[model samples]
Target: MILILFFCFSFTVDQYIENGRPSADPVVVNPVMEEFDPTKKPEFIIKPRKQFADEGKVAKFKTSFEGVAQVNWERHGQLLQQNDKYKMYPALDFHYLEISSVTAEDAGSYTCIVSNDVGSDTASAVLEVFETFKPSPTPAPKKLELDVKLLDRDVLEGTQQVEFKCKFSNATTVYWLKDGRKLTENERRKMTFDGVFAMLIIKDISCLDIACYECVATSKRGEEVRTSCALTVKRDKQDCNDETGERSKAPEIVSVTPSDLSVKSGEAAMFTVNHTGDTEVKWYRGRREVEPDDRLIIDNKSGVGHFTIQNALPTDQGVYNVIVTNKWGNDSMLVRLHVEDTSIFDGRDVKISTENFEDFYILQDKVGKGRFGTVHKCIEKSSNRLWAAKIIKCKEKQKPDVRNEINIMNGLTHSKVLRLWDAYESPTGFIIVTEFVCGGELFERIVDDDFVLTESDCAHFMHQICEGVCYLHAKNIIHLDLKPENILCIAKSNNLIKIIDFGLARCLQPGDSIKVLFGTPDFIAPEVVNYDEISYATDLWSLGVICYVLLSGWAPFTGETDSETLVNVTQAKYDFDEDIFEDISELAKDFIQKLLVKNKDHRMTIQDCLKHEWLALDTVDGQIMKRLSTDKLKTFIARRKWQVPTPASSLKQSNGGGPSGKAFLNGGADHWHHSHHHRKGHMQTPRSSSYSNGQVPWKKNGNAIQAVNRMIGKFSSLSSNSSISSSSSSSPTSSSSLYSKSKQSS
Candidate 1:
């Protein structure tokens, strides 16, 4: 046995030397397992432990055998090196392998071998290496800084082409997002990408095309950038989609031009349309076809047609009609142009007013008629501007007066002063075009639609009037005909007052007085009634009368005849009846009293009117500015009209019958004629009492005034009075008639 052992030891040493293994130690084996023992094969209590570790973590694999055993470790069927990175603990009954700083390179199938005297046992496990480290909360992803921008676009509805584009730098791939979501190929949207641009093409754009679009660009380095913009799609509300597809080709009105447009002279006016399908566009001014010239331009392209008029004039103000025609159908739109008078802006320093009378069309109905001329509503064609065109026949006696009126109008530039746009010579002598105050008379506005006139409203309008008059006074011009009819409201929405009628306006030096009797009877000052000197004080007296009428809706002075009216005016016998003036502020009464004083020198100045305590509503007791019942005032006037005698009979009675009858009627003839004409056209019923522009004398004070106020309450059942007098539009001859007739009759 000893000999056999020596031989085996010698043999082991020789084999170890042949395998090139270090041989500092002797080989040890189990003496009993020198021969194979089938019954005592090795088994394991603990096999290699499966491990999950991070890139820099340590992984351990261990195993223990139960029966008599020897253990060894191998990697990928090859012997493993036992060093600092990989270490193995080998024992008689157990063995373990540990790898520190585990790397992807150290991952593979590792096997453990166990041996007994009879046979060996093997166990294998796989080590999977993932690109990711031990999981942690993900850090914020890096953002791309690529140069990218999206261009915005506007498109019309119906069969239209629309595109969205994005420009980028160094883009690897590009895509689109519609309304915050990824865009894809669909029936309505088509997306494409070029070298550095991304595009979303939409065919047949509709209201649905209105959306925000985004373009996303990604680089080869995995960086991403994006840009976005909104798409505006305008569609015609009336041109709805055909449910049955029957009116597909019909030319429909997309949007009609504004029903009314007010343009200043020498400005441009544009009318535009958008419709579906192919069509031809035609334009007309009144009944005449519009031919394009240097001032008139027509543009029709890509479903849009535009009509523009440059350098618009008073003659350009009128109703314009656009006719759009196609094989399917035809449609039309009307635009009314209201041209503002620019002639008032002309002066020594200003340019000449447009004299093209062809721009304006005169309506047949006359607003006023007198010895001087007739006034008609004229419209400018291109701008839809409205003007009061006064057609005057050339008379040898009226030339200087007309020239003076024009010169005064041309020199004034206050916003509250009526603007005279143009004066043109024609076969009918001359046509003076003035701004059309669409809001009508100030009294008319007060009575409209249950509108309650507050003291603030009064102050507001009064302030404007004072400012305009102040401007006129500074220029040494006096408006002898200032009245409710002459004071026109700028518009219905506002209380802006514009003083009209320069025909009665006379530029006077300070202290200069005109002896020729002028001004309406009711509004004429005491000095004028006494045949005294007429100065700026006369205008103040008229303003006081207007204020009284506005507050109480009754003339301050009224009588059965012009003589009685003149007597009351000359005496300054107007009184504020408490019943009618109960709501009026004491400050307002004071203001009116100051103006209506018998002494013209003591009357309120325009400056004093502006500084009146009544106008200071913001600082005074709020109760004083309470709203007045305009309904009550309108009702009172309606009843007074029925009670008063007919103006025609009164005028005829004042003047004996004459062939000319030129000076045969009293001053009330103009007002009566204008009121009657207005009533015939608008108010078909028994007309309300006409507010005379001439001497309107009230009954002797006290009980008489009380009787009129009481009667007004009972007259509340009458219909709305639609009549508006254009006494402010009278000619020079009629203007003087008011003063001359009152003086003659008295």
Candidate 2:
């Protein structure tokens, strides 16, 4: 009976639904979406697409949502889904902005968009950054000077607002001096405006007002400009409320930073201040008094006392107290100090922002560092973006070096060359901000390892690098330094390679012969060493060397020292070991031989190398020669031990500037690893019977080394214009996209 009633109820409900029983009133439904083509509507826009610092330090973004809907705030990219209600969020554009934290990393691209049932519009803006300035240079005083003329002795009694003023003509920033040391930003009762002058308003004066005081003045010129003055406050004897208590004896003078405060912990810190007082000055390590030993010398005239531990160690960390004694009173200052390794990086002073390791943060771990400073990973602090930071320490005499790198990088826009996103200068070093490549160095991959790069793969990678270098050469820029260590490679899909590292590069000026032998000897062309006359061809020689090394696993020439290498170079030694060769293609062998020619004039140019049948060979995939051009090798290996060609002589000039490490002209050797040769005896040159008239004895054992050496020497004598004018390449295409689009070298 219950089952039957349930079926009856269900049937009654179904009948009611068929009879159109209303639940909430009938809703109107659109038969169709009216043809409101958003693309056909007037483009919506947000004003002030970027955030602007409209008020002091505050930034504002003005937005206008004007496309058929009343825009509401979209909380985290969500639209209000209620029917018949236009609940949309306000869009942010470049000009109009929503306020967020103006962090150092907040400097990035921001976008805003407006949308309705009919249409939507979008806009973007870049965030420009600025910093809030603070007092840069801090000052410390040696003594307090009093101006009796400026004193108001008439206001002499207790609890009176007596004011003290110290004036200096050269001071832009002034700090209240407590005792002898200048007050810091953390000190109490200090206030200032634009870092001009600090005023300490001591509400009520008492017997203690007789204390000595100093005022330190610091110029805005940062760390260099500073001055100080000292003064004494006086009052009647009755102001000495200490009269009611047992008075202690006054103390003597203690040491200061510049004077008595001098320090020599391996190297002295640039920052220091002076110290002085009344009673006998005695240094103490906490409760233990330090005898005035030889290491603790104090000069009364300078009020400076230099202190050094007999042997500084962990036990030296403690509270140092200086007891000053005089007839009036005994004053003591206890300074808590902790000393560790002096070389500890003190980054706080520079105010460099390096926090994240994602998208442009600083790599503080410092994997390795050199003359250019340090290299580390960087992440964007705000967005957590990652980058590589090359911290180049500024040479005091060559401050413009950093700016030169920045200028060059800022103008470069290439996909193969690492892109520079940002740069900044800190008090510590010049930060070269670049995109991070995780693929490591190419030498560490295929060439340095057992893995091999097929001819086409090699061509693909080399072609890209050549393209980038050619672009630079056309701009008259010569990469003074090029080597495996500096070349970076990464595959986008297991095949792409990118060459980087322009640290030692310089612009090739008109009539500017390379006057400095900066590159390593193995890669250094003959002319670069002998006459310091380098052109784009010098870099070309290095590129050839790179290619040869990659395929052959060794340089063309090698020796135990730079001298032997130079001699070999002079002899024009070609196949030092032909027996060590693998079954490589004759085309490949020919191309390598052409590029490695002892004469720079005869070396195959980049274009010629690319066009060579060796590079045109099909890849391992059996693709056609044309299709093989795009193949990239993805393997990675590392070469830690660099082989630098030893110079012919290590002799110092008779004038005597010490032993010479720099080589103006080196020969007879080139960098080669130990395993470059096959097992057993050195390989002999394969053939020489065809070309030589037998006059030069061109074949093996016919002074082949001497002939090659002379060829290199001849190259050193030839001028650049005379040599490159006959070079085999002259493509003028400036951009890759343009080249592909036109399929022509303009």
Candidate 3:
């Protein structure tokens, strides 16, 4: 019964255990375990330190994590990118963030964040980017100070002289003042400054001279310093005597020495007169009273009065009067003083008047024009004589050259050289009045169909040129440019020639080494092209080239281009062409050869050339008297005219109707207009041709001979149809209008 009860209890217990236990299909044992915890949230093993960097440098931030995690970088609370500017490296334990080329904007707080599935750990650091260092600048020196201290003084009335002195330091200018009014230097009052010392002298001081004097000094930096002094005048015995009214005798002139006097400029002149009785003496120039000054002095003592003039000038020439006055009467004497005219330009006696040019002359017609100005035929009003007026526009900078030319021409006196009659200076220009030449240029006569030219005639022309050149050389002057265009005839019927146009002339002193590069290409001397020392012989070379051209109607050194011509001149490359020079005498060729030498020392001088047999009229060979053909000369003149750029209107106005007529006696009316080429500074022979106007054709391989042939062919074809006027006008009709027309076209 008990066993039955136990089984039932056990079954009951089992049923209760089964009902209370968790549901399972089979019985199983569960392993014992603790509560699970995630890996400690990533802890920073090293915190990023603050970084300092300069502009354009690199900055780095690094940190190490205690556990595995993802890493990121942030600046100014913004996530950073791994690009050219920012770079990041993430590893299991180390993390790095790098920045390149740090700038001012890169300075900020940088954060390193490490995160896992649970949480994140972060560290922050500050980045500082500073500008490159630069040192401060030094201070400037202080300005200088000026001291102008003066002393007070007292002087008796009628004192001979009273002076006030002062001193200054580092002052550029100083001025004196009387009672706050500026004091001007005059005859009685004189002001002088030497170095740092200054003085003001008052002569014949009177009661009116009492005043407050001030001196103002100006520093170089424009600062001003000033000081003042008082001047006191005391009563003299002479004033009391005048108030007492003593009886005075009448003044009478006893004798006056030298009633009239004449002196040269810069010379001193004195006049003395004797008078009776006590009197006050005074001197007068014209109607103005003469006072004592640095240049004038007057003294009266012991019944004698003297008036003196120092460093007299032309303006001082006038009538003078001396008067002696007493209480009873006065005596006066009149004297005439004249100061001769002096040289005003470069020690040369060139008198330039400032009066109106129109007052002395009447402009009749416009005859010539050039780059400088215009020329006109004028008639002198007083003499009714014809003269050519060259009106040169004198710019401020160009006045010196014009004045130099005037000085040179004024000193020259020769029959073969053109004469300078007068010169006047105007506000805008200069009017140069010269002798009137009715004839035209030498080449102009050669180009005439009816004109007859012989070797003797050429010799006569050269003789005149040599005479003029010899005269110039005697005065240490060299006419560097000698050409046919510069030779002028006195009249159409006369054989006399005048050498004109001294524009390129120079007055060289002994031992002077001056080199200049300027002249026509065809006539340029070898020394000119070589930049050698120029002497009197340089002009002889040009004369040689002129003779060659006159004989052959072609320039000896002329090539297709100016550069080639220059090269040929430098090498002294020229030959007497048989086609044109066959009839020319051997003596003439010998003269040219002697003068055309490359060495200036070996070149024939003007005096030697004048003695050559070719120039001697008595020794002229029959071959020299032979008539030369004018066809080549006409071709030359036509080619020259064509080469000169001309306006269309110039063709119709060839008969002295154009502005370019024979206006000036000087042959420079077409100076710049006909200049083939004018080069300055150092010269270089070009390997290729450089055509200035684009009218000339380019030559292959710079073949000068081929180019010359082409030019001759081109000009020869047009010579038959070219009817150039051979007027006796010294002006260029085509080139004169060219300058204005070119300006208009531009």
Candidate 4:
């Protein structure tokens, strides 16, 4: 058996080439051998070389052999024949196979066989197909619609400005040209492209701007569409009468836009004028012609003129004019349009006619005071309207932050968020005017003697809070301090809540973060305590604390002191404690738990909280909500408030550089929670008695408010206690008077 196996191995070894290279075995004849016979055996003189081909290109493999009469070719062991795709060339010295339009599938080993009557010889070469990168025409929309509209005013001399707008549909790569020269964006020449539209605003127009301006929109396919406008810069020496088509007579205006117009921000505003005769009319913003398109529009025909502004913004406020010209003469009307901000505050249209702070009738005594200044209940003498004004001293250092807050408020608008009526600079300080919330703090309402906040009340209030907060988040405003004190009721009769006190608030850009450790200790997120990046999640954590306190009247993480509470927050050490959460629904606890997660990314978002089962009022019955136990919550709140002494420092004004805003007390420790069962009239007792009734053992200036405009690098967030005052005038001084007035108005 061993001898037979050895013989078989020797036979197999003789049939294969050693190392897969050319073999010179005695049985294989050599091409140089003079005794070689064409029918005896085949020998290779040239072996096939590896070939490479690009996709769609032709590829060829060839080899030469001696003593062979027949040549055959195969690919990957498959027999090949001459065809349209494959060509075979056989000669006495060479044999070859050709593949036309080579593809990826054509890539493989090609074997050439040279044979005689006696034996055969084989040589193989690899065919590799590669992809070629060729220049391709850019793909773009061919049928583009292009329109050019005047943006600002007509081009005048160097004094005025001009703007032209170009709009395109289904195109790309937009650029502008002036007098055939491509114009690049610069300080004076501005261009902006918003996918579908392109605008070119030119300031300081002169004779150089008199040439034609062209807007060209090009696609990657090298296709382009263009629109052009000729700007005729009229000098002061030019005859206005000639342009009007008359020598002496000029246009006479029968009517024009009002001297002043006002519109709320984010809304639309229109201006129209009634005039006589066919007069040439043009619109101008300051020295520049107001472009008739973009955000502004103008129509002058049939002796009437109309100017409309869509989505009026505060930046749109400017002095505008309409110049009417005719053969006889010309007349122009200057109109000033003011776009008021209605976001952070309300009643922006109510003009504060009085410039002096003292001009307002001090409607009541000071209701609340903080680091900013005293909260006042004042009435405008002319309108007798009520308002709440929080005055902050405008020292140079604080001016920028104060102005920033004003600017932020000016841009915000949400039902659940407070609105800024107006911000005025006074000799004493800056008066931030906001609508008076007569219902006072929701915390006060929850603990009121006769008012027990059923789960329904909590849900309603929480929904409103979510709605407002969602809007704020949409606008990129993060209310770093969200608590019961910051949440105010529209009025006693109206349970709607409005978020206030943006002192710690910040407007975030994408991927922004805060890390100054600035929130109430008990409600502060673990990330904040660890000095991690603060984000919108910080507000969510605070909201969780508010929900917990509102439902259970107990803090989830508050310790005896601020430091201890901060440690607990850092460790996320808190629990339902069974006893406190026994009456709270599982859904409510779930919502709070999700928000209170130590990991910010794991925390529930405002959108998620809004959809939580506890807040999903649409799916739940009103009866179920109303049936949720509030008696236990009420008892816990009252007992806790009376039990914990109002820290003198909590009521005392702190000059320290921390968040001196109102602290988020576990149970609204700043104010007393009156018994709901107390026998009283239709009017609820005011908070003024807390100071007089001895519930507050401290005065207003004893560091009572802890979070005061915390330092953030060079910037400071101006956090001051928001005073509950009247909405019509400025901040009223006393809450009792406002309550009385609110009851009468109701």
Give the TM-score of each candidate: 0.47, 0.37, 0.42, 0.41
Task: Identify the runs in model 4 with alpha carbons over 4 angstroms from their true place.
Answer: 1-355, 358-365, 381-384, 618-746
- The candidate maximizing lDDT is 3
Most TM-score-accurate candidate:
1
Error of 1 at 665 (Å): 13
* Full ranking by TM-score: 1, 3, 4, 2
Candidate 2 global CA lDDT score: 0.42
Task: State the lDDT of candidate 1 residue by residue for 99-173, as single tens digits.
Answer: 888889878888988776677888887776554556898765444454556666655567567877767766778
Candidate 3's error at 247, in angstroms? Answer: 99
1 versus 2: better lDDT goes to:
1
The TM-score of candidate 1 is 0.47
Taking the tens digit of each residue's C-alpha lDDT, what string does model 4 give over 184-205? Answer: 9887889989978888888887
Candidate 2 structure quality by residue, lDDT tens digits, 200-293: 4443554343333445555444433333222222233222337667544333333333322222221222212244443355555433456532
- Summarize candidate 3's per-residue lDDT along 1-746 as a digit string, tens digits: 55554454345334333434312221111111322234656668789999999999999887775544556778878987657787665322345677899988999899988777777888999999998876777554235454557877766667899988888777777889885579999999999888588789999987567666878878656788787676655542222236657745567667777667888754567889999878888876534577564346587897998887654556667656676777665556556677886522223355899999888899866665664576676777875555667787655654665676677788776767776778998878688876555456677766677677888888988898999999999998887667666677655444777777665567777656655444556676766555456789988998998888888888887765444565677779789888889889888899999999988999888899999988986335567667888777777665655564322112222111232332122222222111112234534432223334423232222222122222323333443323212111122211122111111121
lDDT of each: 0.60, 0.42, 0.64, 0.60
Clashes of 1: 35
Clashes (N, CA, C under 3 Å) per candidate: 35, 100, 1, 73
